[model samples]
Target: MKKITTRLATMDDIDQLADMFDAYRQFYELAPDLALSRQFIRDRMLGSESVLILAEDEEGASAGFCQLYPTFCSLAAAPIYALYDLYVRPEARKLGAGRALLLAAEAHALRNGALRLDLTTAKTNLAAQSLYTALGWQRDDIFYAYSKTLAA
Candidate 1:
């Protein structure tokens, strides 16, 4: 296994991040659309809508990535991060890339004075669940997460 390095992604990394992002969507059973993925990542990076972190192995191959969106916690009265996406390449599994990315995201959030960081994953993604829990991420059992689809 190679050493994993993580850093805040910038515009220069969009191409690499987009590739990883597309693969991530595929992991969720979404159709592969590199162009859409690239454009979406480009919009976020250019607009500052989220904090993106990219991970690379010792050899500098794109290993994985995690994206954190900033939002206010009304009750806590402070900002927080919604870790909306985390993905590690299949070949990079068990190499600490995911953990490194998660830690990087946490550091970014804390550095910005965030009150907490939250995320949700497919219940069937046992590997991700184990990784998250092993890294001290608490599983929420209180309120249920709800969402509504709006026409785009």
Candidate 2:
């Protein structure tokens, strides 16, 4: 079996990260927009608003990527990270790329003194939910999440 390696992503990784990000957005039924994706990832990296981790296969191919955004938890009065994205290429599935990326994100959060890491997946994404739970992430059954979109 090929080994997977995970690391913190740098600006130089924007191209690979953008490709994976575009694919991830497409997984949510969004249209493919590599240019926009590249810009978004580049902005995030340059702005230092998010922490990204990349996973590479034994051959150094882009296997997966995960991103974490730091935010304050009002109720808890503490710092936390929102794990906004995680994706593994189709050919990389079942090879532990996703799990590796997730673990790397968690480690980064912990090292940064984050209170906790939070994430939400589509309700129909059972595979992701399963992976999260199996990795000891508690499912929030206490509070219902609501979102409101404002006109731009």
Candidate 3:
């Protein structure tokens, strides 16, 4: 495995990040639309709506990326981060990029005074569940997450 490095992404990284973002949506069964991917990532960066982390391999190729949204957990009464997206390129799997990205996200959250970092993965994504477990993330057995689609 090659060395994987992670850092907060800046506007200059939009191009590479958009490419991986497109793949990430495809991983979730969304139709591929490179233009849409670029615009969405650009909007986030422009609006400062989400914190983006970029991971790169030793040769400086895009390895993976993670997105975090700063929000507060009402029960905790403190700021927290929702780790909404985490994706490693197909070829980058098992190279430690995912782990590196998650670590970077946590460091960022802590530095910003967040109480904790939270994330949800598909029930069938066993690999991601395992990684979260190994990283000391505890599953919330007490609450069942539910959501309803709203009209756009």
Candidate 4:
């Protein structure tokens, strides 16, 4: 297994991060658009509204990334984070990069005094669910997620 290192993503990592993000979106059958991906990540990084962590191998190549958004839990009166995305390159899966990215995100949440972290994965992604379960993440049994597209 290769040694994996995780760190907060920087502007220098935008190109690789964008590519990985595009792949991640496509994994859910979304259309590919590098420019849109780049701009989305750029805005998040510049606005500081979210945190993006990148996993790299010993050779300094990007292996994976996880993006988290800060949110508040009004009822709990505490901070929370929504882990919107996590992805490891096909060649990097099972090499500890994904786990490293997850751990890194958990550490960031703890460091920021967040009370909890939440995420949703596709129902068909059993492998990812296994990983989340192994990492002590509980399956949400309380509520279902709903979304509606807004007019642009």
| Model 4 TM-score, all chains together | 0.97
Question: CA lDDT of each candidate?
Answer: 0.93, 0.93, 0.95, 0.95
On a 0 to 100 scale, what is the lDDT of residue 97 in model 3? 90
Residues 83-114, candidate 1: write the lDDT tens digits. Answer: 99999998998999999999999899989999
Residue pair clashes in candidate 3: none
Off by over 4 Å in 3: none
TM-score of decoy 2: 0.96
Note each model's CA RMSD in angstroms: 0.9, 1.0, 0.9, 0.9
Candidate ordering by lDDT (highest first): 3, 4, 1, 2
lDDT of 4 by residue, 1-152 (tens): 78999999999899999999999999999899999999999999999988999999999999999999999999999999999999999999999988899899999999999999999999999999999999999998999999998995
Give the worst 10-residue stretch by lDDT in candidate 3. 143-152
Cα TM-score of candidate 1 = 0.97
Candidates in order, TM-scores: namely: 0.97, 0.96, 0.97, 0.97
Instruction: In angstroms, give how far residue 5 of model 2 lies from its true place.
Output: 0.9
Q: TM-score of predicted model 3?
A: 0.97
Model 2: per-residue Cα lDDT over 15-91, one tens digit each: 99999999999999999999999999999999999999999988889899999999989999999999999999999
